[model samples]
Target: MALLSDGHFHSGETIAQQVGLSRTAVAGHISQLSDWGLDVFKVKGKGYRLERGFSLLNAESIKKHLGNTKRAMIDVESVLPSTNTEMKKRIANARHELADGDAIFAEIQTAGRGRHGRTWLAPIGGSLTFSMYWSFPDGYQSMAGLSLMVGLAVCEALKDFGVDDAELKWPNDIYLQGKKLAGILIEVEGQIGATAHSVIGIGLNVCVPDSQYDVGQPHSDLTSYLGHTPDRNSLAAAIIKSLWTLLPKFTQQGFGPFAPHWEALDLYADKRIVLQMGEKRFSGIDRGVDASGALLVETQDGITRFHGGEVSLRGNR
Candidate 1:
């Protein structure tokens, strides 16, 4: 796999010799790569190569980019069922090693998930899927708009990477020209009166291949805008750096400081949209979000504030 990762073709005999495997075994391994969402191109005599190539995640590169100021335990895995699930388990058993800013990254997730019980499909080496564990001194009540603040941090990181047009959809989605570019799912665990811990899971499409599975929504990747694929390790490091800086501010000021920035990047601001809350729906013009980050919508009757739980927003389609 490392030899083919260079985006160049390698003969079957050469690959077999390098890996000390029979040619038949090598062929079987190549076939399994296709099942893992990689585009393997095989020719009659030219051997095999990845269609768009791949860049394996490097933990050391990521840590170097993060530098000295960012204090977090970073773990990288080639495969996992879900980063969030893994982080939660670590928190439960290895709480001594974990801290407020610990994070985990996975190259591929076999059972990734999103908000509302939706499956998140992240191809191997194609997307950035990671989870960060954060602890807040305040209780759950004071964490009203933490997700919105995290979205702001992601948008800021994207801007730093030259993706300036990314916008924030209400609740926890990042859109590029109406197509989904990224999504966030935050899971919290704690008692009502004690400190709260949040597992922030983020999935961003970087260079995903065409999939047979239906994502059920329009989507776009970073390569579509950047003209080339960015290194996943570097991008992850940038995002972590941004989060490290933004979280302290959020802990001090709550969501009030981030409200204006979020509104400026809001894709549905001043636009007609529908808010789906289970079986019921409400149509209104988006008036941006209030200081508390609850979406403010102006319906036919009057203005109302809607919180994030079980609520999904979409533009008129």
Candidate 2:
């Protein structure tokens, strides 16, 4: 796994020969890779190799960087169909199986999803696809601006990677130079009378090149935008650490403590902008977000605050 993760692929024969296993066994393993949601290619003459290799997400590597947070609850997978979907399934089965701060990470996700029912494109070795599973004691209603808070964590994590210019575009999109570089998707699953379980999914463009931005519009990657890519293990560790530190506060203070930081990084702050909310479109000056994490827009009618749901904030023409 480590050798494969170093950014190259080996044929079934090579892998089997190196590991002293039968080629048939190696072929079986390659076939089973898809079960973990990994896309593996098999060429009769050339053998099998990953389209692109990603630093394999391993428990020990991540846990080492995690330090004390490792005990908080973590699940690292080499590959997963979708971390968010997997967490949702786990939460449905039994919340107790995973702790309040549980997180799931994958090197490559075959079926990742984004907000507004959009499919998230996580080309092999291009980005980070991970989901943090959290159980909020105060319930979903109490943490009204939870998604915004998660966005704040993402912004902080990026800054730690030396991308201090990164900005947040409302709800939960990370941007650099007016282009999207990452996104956050929050899914809440709560029992009728029980606490709310949240799966905070973050898709970060770590090392994707400009040429690979076909799936989404005006997207940039941290490595391409920053000139160098930080070690994936280090970046993942920093993000997880910040998230673990902030989750407890978010549950307690909601978005109160994070409002200032979020406001500082608002991409559309104090600028005349257009907001797309479903079929209705409104033009307003971005007055920054409110205490509850809702976007406050100074419009022709007055100041309007929006909470969530397909709200697009863009600079006014």
Candidate 3:
């Protein structure tokens, strides 16, 4: 798989010889790659190649970009059901050795998830799918605005990588020209009075191919704006580093310092919008988010605050 990851075709006989596998066995492996959402192209005599050339995530490259930070344990997986799930299992097993800033990156996620039980579609090498474990001394209630802070971190990281137009959409989405470029899911497990542990999952589209997959909403990838794909390792490192730097301040100062920046990058601020909670809906003008990161919407009747869980927002359109 690494050999063909360069997006060039290699003959099955050559691949078999290189991997010391029978040609028939190699064919079986190729078939399984499709199940991982990797687009493998097989030509009559040329052998197999990826639909496009992409570099696999390199942990060292990510660390190098991170630079002189706390010793962050980085795990890179070629395929996983979900990085968030993997991190949770580790925590469940009482892996106390795992500290804040530890992260996992997956090349392809077969069962990646989003808010509202949506499937997170991450084609191999087409998107950045990863999760980081962050711990706060404060309890879960004190982390009310944490997701909004993370959204700001993502926007700052995108700007660092020369992606200037990325904007924040309410609670946990980053958008480019109103199309979603990234989404975030935060899951925490901790007792009421104890320190909170959050598994922050992020899925940022990098180079999704034009295909028939229904994403269920307008979406955009970095390739659409940058005219070329950015290195996944570099992008991942930027995001991780940004979050690492921000988490401590967030724990200390809460969301106050980040409020101005969040509003600056807000996609729907002061615009007509709709908020949905289950079957209930409210239309209002976006007043941006409050100090606690609850969305502030000024409806015809009065102002309403909507938190992250079980709520969705849409533009007037």
Question: Which candidate tops TM-score?
Answer: 3
**For candidate 3, lDDT tens digit of each residue in 1-317?**
68888999999999999999999999999999987767899899788988888899989999998889778898899888899999988877865567889999998788999987799999778899999998877789888898899999998899887888789987899998778888999999788899888999999999874453458888888887889899899999999989988989998899988888899998998999988888888899999888899898998778888888788888888
Off by over 4 Å in 3: 210-213
lDDT of model 3 at residue 124? 79
* Residue 120, model 2, lDDT: 89
Q: Candidate 1 lDDT, tens digit per residue, 1-317?
A: 67888899899999999999999999999987787777899987999988766888877889998889766788899888899999888867854567777889998788899998899989777799999998877878777888898988998889878998989998999988778989999998778888888899999999753354347888888877788999888999999989999988888888988899999999988999998898999999999888788999999889999998889888877
Clash pairs (backbone) in predicted model 1:
none
Q: How far is 121's C-alpha from truth in model 2 (Å)? A: 0.5
Query: How do these models rank on TM-score, best leading?
Result: 3, 1, 2
TM-score winner between 2 and 3, please give it: 3
lDDT of 2 by residue, 29-138 (tens): 76766454356777677776666666655667777887875486667776677999988998889545887667788776777888888888886566788898888776
lDDT of 3 at 156: 84
The Cα error of candidate 1 at residue 20, in Å, is 5.8
lDDT of 1 at 59: 78
Better of 1 and 2 by lDDT: 1
